[model samples]
Target: MKRGVEEIVPGTPPKSEEEVIEARASFRKQYRFPPENNNLTAAQTRKVRLIYEIDITLSEQIDALSQLAKLNLAIRNILPPETWESVASIPDLSSQQVSLKVLDSLYAVRNNLSRSGELARRETRRTDRNLDLATRSYERAEKQRMDFEDRTGAEDSNSSIVTDRETAALASQAAEEKLALRRLQSRLAQAELALVDNKIERFQPFLADHRLRVIFSPEHVQEQIGAFSAKEADLEKSLLASQEQFDQLTPNAPVSTGLVAAEVTPGETVRQLAQSYGRDAAHARVSLNQSWINHLNIQRQFYGHRVDFYQNKIKRRQMSEITRELDLEIQRLESETDYLRNRMAQARQDAVRIGDQFAGTTGISPQLIQSLQDAAQEIVETLRMEALSTESTLSRLRNFNDELLNRTSGYTWHEIQAILGDRLPLAWNYQLFILNDRAFRVSTLFWVVFLVVIGFFFARYISRTAGSLLTSKAHLAPGVSAAYEKLVLYLLVVVICILIFNLFNFSLTSLTVVSGVLALAVGFGSQEVLKNFISGIILLIERPVHKGDLIEMDGRILKVESIGLRSTQVLDFDNSQKIVPNSLLLENVITNWTLSDNILRSTIPVGVAYGSPTRKTAEVLLEATRSTEGVLASPEPFALFSDFGDSALGFTIYFWTNTADRLKISSEARHRIAEALATENIAISFPQHDVHLDSLNPIRVELSRQS
Candidate 1:
């Protein structure tokens, strides 16, 4: 099955033995590889396929290595040193080395152009493929239309045929437009590539000459100043042209062409146009303002660079001539920035004029004014983002320049900072809100924060003062005073919140959504809590049980300690604090001893021996009750002989006292009654019992001792 190399490979036949040997050697060089075999076994086919796969992989590896080499060369030609800090010792040499930094930027631009070109090429191929497919589809549609035209059909069928023909024609038109768009894109890519090439061709020569002058002859650097000045002049001219364009430009209102005046009312049409006009004008105005700010910052940076460059030249004569043109370049930047500032102001005025056009016009709708305000708000938000970005860029630039100045100059850090405008006021005047053309700025944020902090203390003070008045002057119950204080505090807090919302131009109506969410939450899970809160409010208002009032609930005696919104605090008989839900008090049957008054009636019972002196026992009981502390003398103590028992005559006494001290009064009364009964020889009795045994159990009484 083995074939000669000349048979397997497509090449001239080897005429001599040496040539055959060379061919065989080359074939075997690919290690187990076989050339194309049209008629071969399965094993030879596998070997050929494997050889093809290896060829593709090797080709890709070679391409990757070539790209890597190109990148390495670029780095070597344009990259700065790995250690920038160490370069400060040899400033001239370092500047001369990094003088090609401009070339790096140029190379980046070229790389972008190349990537764009590659994409354009891919788009071209894809569009060409699509065009081919579309052409085939159009041909198919046309053939269908012609066949339908040749057929004899009903009237309805003829209409369908006409429709089919129109569809075919439309498809053809679309294909033509697609091809045209592709051609235009290809031309655009070519033009961009040419522009990049031209810039490189023009700038690279100048860079090379400047580098040579810095390296070989530093004295002839003054001659190159004229060339740099000419370049600056060119840049100035370009800046002027751009400013002119910016000034002349007006953003067209984005009104839809489909909005027909006949379809809508005259007012509606005007409203739509007004909305678009206001938005467009506002966008233009914000854009101009942002550009002006950016230009101002750039001018400041140029001024710093210029001063640094001049200071370096004054301090050291050995500065590299390559960077000498940087001073003129910075001057040019400053001049261009000034020009931008003037033109941006003009553009801003024009935008204002457009935005205010409806102000003096008759029959202006309120909706139009509202739309203008809304557009201004949108631009305010956009400006906020732009301002933050500009602020970050300025800070980074300042830091970088400050560090560079520190490393390369004899100036102190503070001096460098001052030179970089570190002492300039911050952007606190930047508008954060635009309400009907009125601005609320970053300074307003400070006011809001101040108000919030001070409002907290102020609310507390007012609540405390109100609480004192309710407790002292009004003689209100403690729980009621606390409730009123809380209400006052919350009212103050709400007022402060409203003021804060007003500062941001937020309507309280917006809280309806928040209220809805809260209502949903309450309906789902807080029914019992809400019930308790309402019950607490009822308790405070109706004064059902005041603080220090004794009450018995669910067989336990408790004193009301404090009433709150959700629950009430009480002290049990054991003096332990307990939290009871307000709903429990309202729902459960509770006995309030001091609901009407604190006076409570308590009863004491006594038994005297065997009817010897029942009247005396009653007298003794009455005397003890009258002598007891906290017993109300106005509701005088009363005693009576009630029931006759087997051992003694039972007597009862009743007394009135403060409900809170009832238990203590009863205890003290019992002690006094016992002492008085003993003094009167009226013996208090105990239970007596008599037993009878009918059997002979009492006859024999014996005692036995166990061993």
Candidate 2:
């Protein structure tokens, strides 16, 4: 028992004798010992004495009792004393309970330690993953920053080189300008000398001609000048009279004086009298003779009393010489003006050429130079802003690159190559890094042009295919067959073009953004063009009217010719073609005669005297329509007694004709009706009214008074 208690406590020693005695008495009621024959035997006492010695206390009895007491106290502390006695009644509880309590404490401690270890392992793994991802992100960012820095540095170098070249070119241009100014001064001096020489050479000849004209044949010159002036005056008067007659005469009126004279002549045939006028007898004699007579009469009435006819003739002759001299002087002045104009034009061209050269040397655009300098100022401002932005970005990139280089200084080129192998070819990696150090503008331009060429060819192919498809007329409704086919082809081409753009790596999202901006610009810039495009699409889809339909739009009756993307062409009633914007047709109301069906009804109205039978007239008109070649027979021609006028009965001949032959059928039918009416002895009415008057009582009263 002592050994068992020792096992529970492990290395703990036994308690004192006084404590044992008290313990035995306290535990006696709660604890039980093994049953014997009624009392303790000598062997059991000896065994108890041996257990007490092994327990290592001052008195064996006291030690055994103290151990029992300690066990009782332990039990009472753990459980109620009443339950403890029941629990301890079972054998070996002191040892078993102590062992179980030790095991429970050990298991609790082990579980806590294991949980702590697991938490530490998870935290380590999480930390390692975070560090790795951060390292990769930092490395990628560093590479991008280095690339940007290298590009910026190269651009700065190029800009500096361009500036140096521009400065040198400007200096050269200044020198050239100075030399050109000196040459212009020398040429002006030479021109002044040449003008003086020319004046001296021409002066003597001019004086000689003036002297001869004044001295020799003065009277003859005067007579010739007077005769020429009189003839010119007569011609002017005739011309004025002819113009006045033309203005006063109607288009259908007689135009010749000779024709009028023939009409008035007695016992002369009209043809013979007319032939006596001129070879162009019909035109010369028809109406102009009357005009000439009226003009002569007006002149005699207005100016005959003021001057003698012969004296007036002499005055006009003198005026002719003066007019001739004045004309000569005017001609000379005009020649001089023409020469001056040509010289001025040449000077302007020279100035323009010089200005263009100056612009080229200075790397300035001529249009910008001519824009009053405002554009140049704006360009300079823009450049300054761009430079500042570029400089700031370059500095940031440089700083980032420096940080990257410091962090990765220990890494080898092979290590970088390995990391970036997936993105770039292994052989090209070194080349790419070296090329990144200088300007890569040439390579960028080459790629840009390559992409543009690809896009251009793709667009061309789509446009050609679409144009061919639209022009074909295979698949469409009967009413809008031609137009619908064309529209489908056009839409397909556009869709294919958009798909080709997508194939070239252009995203719909980016295209949408660009289209939105362009739409805003177009809305503000060209509203009419936008309206036409939208209207054209609507017209193609709705097909309210179509090609070949007879329609009237904007008061113009025409046959639809062609419907294009932007405009519609129509042939008018007069056979003239007009191109109308699609927007106008879509927005305005139009009359379509053959939209639904090709058969059209045309009406021809005729009036006969009221004495004629209305039924007979209707029958004659219908017979006339039936005989017409283009009139339709299935619907059968008919006529109606439409109305009764004051002098005549109005009848309308109704006939059906194909829309294409509507005009021809109407015209022919009218002609046939006129012939039929003539055969029937029915007279056509004219606009005529008769008035009757009566005199009442006055005549009879006057006669009675006279008798």
Candidate 3:
């Protein structure tokens, strides 16, 4: 069947009566769209299905959970002051558990209020519709009554017929609807209040504890540790130096019988008795120094150990939690301190043995030798005591940790979860997807970009396949082959970009509005990128610069290796890769040596001593160019008398060669030219200055190099 307007042939008017009849008869339907049924009935309102789809499929539930996880992370990151980051003090598990139970009640109340709010909304809608129907019924009845009275005379019409009982019923119905709406709205208001108040009440205790901890917590235990460590280091260094000096003293050497320590047996002038003792006097002096150093070591060890005690206190700051990690750390410290104690005992035994040897050989007083040995023994003893005390402290800390863990472990799992703060429980932290919280909600755009990247690499594979086919089956220069592949890839990119832009610009919105904003953004945000793209397009089309062309820009010569969409990679003389923006080559004055053709003219300036024949030198230089490789034979090499320098006549040798690395080829030709010149007895020269001296003014001389 033909639909009327759709089947009507374009530009075909009904030229006859029969055609008009046929057209009229064939008026058939082309489309039937869905019907609008927006009005909800009372039954539907009463049975309001939950808007949140709790009975979703497993996959959909997982998706919802994933979104909730993202929301949780965003809340954690953006609301740190409200979370554990701002928590100053941790409350006991029991206290925290009590607060959490209260919070659970509050959540239950909130959920109930939420359900009631939905019910009240439905009731309001039902009552509103009832009121509308009643108003319409009243108007219709009034109209009928009025028309009935107009037929008869108004004076003869009965009050019961015109002003019927329906009027009072309509008024009562409207009043009832108004009262029901008010009651529902009032209940909703109270629910909202009760929900908010319960939330504040539940969280008040945690916030109060956090605030107190933040205010009163120790801030810089690290600084105090540093100060105590400095004193400890000074005392340790002094003790080590004393031990070294004591060990270095020679045993069995002469005691000093001089003014040193003033113990020379009341000598006739204290220095004269020391001369008599000879080596004995020197040994006596060393013994006195060793004894004094040992006395200082004992004092140093006592104070240093005290500093160590204070440092241990500093290290123990803010670790009140009984975590598995703390237990491991305490055990590690215990083993290390035990090892330190054994090392200290070994050092003390060596010191005691040396002290006894000095007392026996040098015949020093037993008391003085005993002092040295006692100081060493005392330091080792102090270290051992400190080690024992640390071990005891560690044991106590472990007991404390065990007790706390047991207390927390006695609670229900959910209660323990409360003490761990508000991270999502392990059950819900599924790594279904990685999150970039900065653009949390716009993850779809990120997916699009990620997919586009995969597509971009796929596009490259296609380009490379096409390129490889060309290289294997067809003969093309490397440069042309590369250009072909890049051209195909760039075309794909341009098409894809346009398609993506149009998809956004024209779908679900006005094309003109989106295009205007897009144009403005591109113009302002990526104008340079756009310029480079356009410049690259021009270079590709114009062929003024092609891959493998040797060109110079900004006084540096580089060979074009690859032409990208926005930039070109070039290899310089040193074979170093340099990336130049497409716009840079297009906009600047670049010299393209291999642009027009690969045949290029190269010049090498030459100079011979002032007396050398310019023409002969030219012949020699030109002849040398003939033997050099890569030089064009058709356009034969030529030389010219170019300049007259201070002491040399300069000549220029010119040659045409197929383009190559400019420096390499030019260097070869120049070497040949110099050899040709040397063989001809024409010398390449340096500039020389002549001086004339006047006897009276004697060439004013500086002692530096003179010509």
Candidate 4:
């Protein structure tokens, strides 16, 4: 080897100066190696080598630790911190092995921040837009407020004007009232003056009569005296005529000569001749005289003796005179009586005539004269009042006519009269007469046409309306339609019969009264039946119940099968039909199932064994309810463990169904529950009895011994 410029030292090798420089350069180079080189000694590097090794190892650990820290941070970001410990303890490579993990996390964070920022910006923009819209709305509202204020001001002004108009109207009314009051006062004063004038005029006749009271006299006594003297002269003339007739009759009677001869013989006494004459005469005369005297005596005795005769004659004469006077008095009395009787008869006739006259004139009795007089007086007063009123009206009319004439000054009264005269005849004979004739013809035609038209319309209306009503499903219940139709036909026929009778001018009023009385009798006799009849009519009119309805009455639910006039038939839930009186139905309270639209609710209760998990049982029941056919789903089924029982839990499962056949649905639900219970091995308990025999052998022995 070539000896280099080396200085040998004790226990040390020496190198040339160039070698040292190179070694130094190499050391420097090694020390100055790039960060990627990692060329360091394991030792003899001032522990820098160990330190470097350690640092290298530590760098890996540090990287791993840093990655774990980052992973912890990432986990903290992804999940809650409390979850980190549990997750970190899991056997897996730390985050250091995971390349790009931090980068991904950073990117995720950045993206999230960016999205959040964008959302914030959009929200800010939306807020600004809303603020702008609110500002515009406020402006519009302000404009509306201003417009409302203007309208309010105008309304106030209009109101003020209206108030002023009302005030002016009130003032005008007050002024008119004052003027009317003045006019009334003036009219009262004028009426008072007129009344005074009328009273003064009425008293004028009385005053004139009083002035002429002393100028009256009487003159009638001379006529009475002359009439009495004429009566006395006629009486004297009749008496003289009676005396002259009596003298003439007395001169014509026969003479008596024996009385004179007897007077001459009594003075002379010629003895013998006188004696002989006397004897002869006496004998002859005595014989004749005796017979005559006897006859006369007998006659006188038959009549009475001479003195007694004279007395009797005097008595008879006196009696005749008395009788004649009595006759005269009786005749006078009879004449007076006759006169009185004739006067009474005349008076009675006059009274009868007066009654007849009263009857003929006023068709009433004379006893009602006071009432008649009062009526006449009232009529007279009324007439006087009417006359006064007519005069007033005439005055008013005259004033009105004068005012009209003065105002117009065009037509003269003669011109008016001429115009009236010219129009009167034409109006009376031509226009009015022709119109009357035409009206009579029109009225006849109208009555004829109206009767015909109304009859036809009434017939048709009755037929159609009754037919429609009887045929309607609602009116004619299920089984009674035929009967109702017959009833309707009968009613129509009866109505037609009545109408025909009316057409013939029969007195339907009397007939109707009789019919009403008959109806009353029938109604009283059959109140329940008549009530049913009336109730049927009310049912038809009011339509409270109809066919095919479900109703509950008298604690029985049934379907309406037939509604007859007398009775309503119903098919009960048991499928048996029953007939009920219409009156009874109407009079009693009833529940109509279909009245509130055919909706019904049905409830079913169930129980499950206790200690079988109440929640689980409820869930099962709800499931069963939901699965049941015909159960409503939108409302959902619910189950409730209502109570705990001794051996089971009481539960209620509620569901809804719209099936028309409720019985079938209920049966099916029960079957389904039974099947489900069987499949789930669930026990269903029943009321039961258990018996025990403590000593079967003793009982058997005792039975054997008894046998």
Better of 3 and 4 by lDDT: 3
Q: Model 3 segments beyond 4 Å from truth?
A: 1-447, 469-474, 494-515, 574-579, 609-616, 641-650, 658-661, 683-707
Candidate 4 Cα outliers beyond 4 Å, as residue runs = 1-501, 504-507, 573-575, 633-638, 642-647, 657-659, 688-706
Which model scores highest in TM-score?
3
lDDT of 3 by residue, 1-707 (tens): 11121122233321233432342233211111121226844333222221111112222323433443343343233332234322323233224222322322333343444455566456546655664665665566456645655666556656553333333333343343333333333333333333333334444554444322221112333444454466556656655665565456445434442123444332222223223222332333343334334433433333233233223321222223324545665677578567757866774775665454454444355555555455555555555655654554454344335434543434445445564565434323434432322222244455557756876887788888877887788976566667778777877766666666454442423346667888899999989999999988777766677788889788887889889879999998887999899998878899988766778888888778988887777778877888888777888888889888877898887888777655577999888887787888877899778897558665666677778
Q: Which pairs clash (backbone N, Cα, C closer than 3 Å) in model 1?
A: none
* C-alpha lDDT (0 to 100) for residue 463 of candidate 4: 54
Count of residue pairs whose backbone atoms collide, per candidate: 0, 12, 8, 0
Ranking by lDDT: 1, 3, 2, 4
The local lDDT score (0 to 100) that residue 551 gets in candidate 1 is 89
Candidate 4 vs. true structure, TM-score: 0.29
- Candidate models: Cα lDDT each: 0.59, 0.51, 0.54, 0.46
Two-way lDDT contest, 2 vs 3, winner: 3
Better of 3 and 4 by TM-score: 3
lDDT by residue for model 1 (438-527), tens: 576778777878888899789989998999999999997675677677667767988997888787776767668778999999999999
* Per-prediction CA RMSD (Å): 30.8, 64.7, 47.4, 69.8
In Å, residue 680's CA in model 2 sits off its true spot by 0.6
Candidate 2 segments whose C-alpha is farther than 4 A from its true place: 1-479, 511-513, 698-707
**Lowest lDDT 10-residue stretch of candidate 2:** 302-311
Q: Each model's TM-score?
A: 0.36, 0.34, 0.36, 0.29
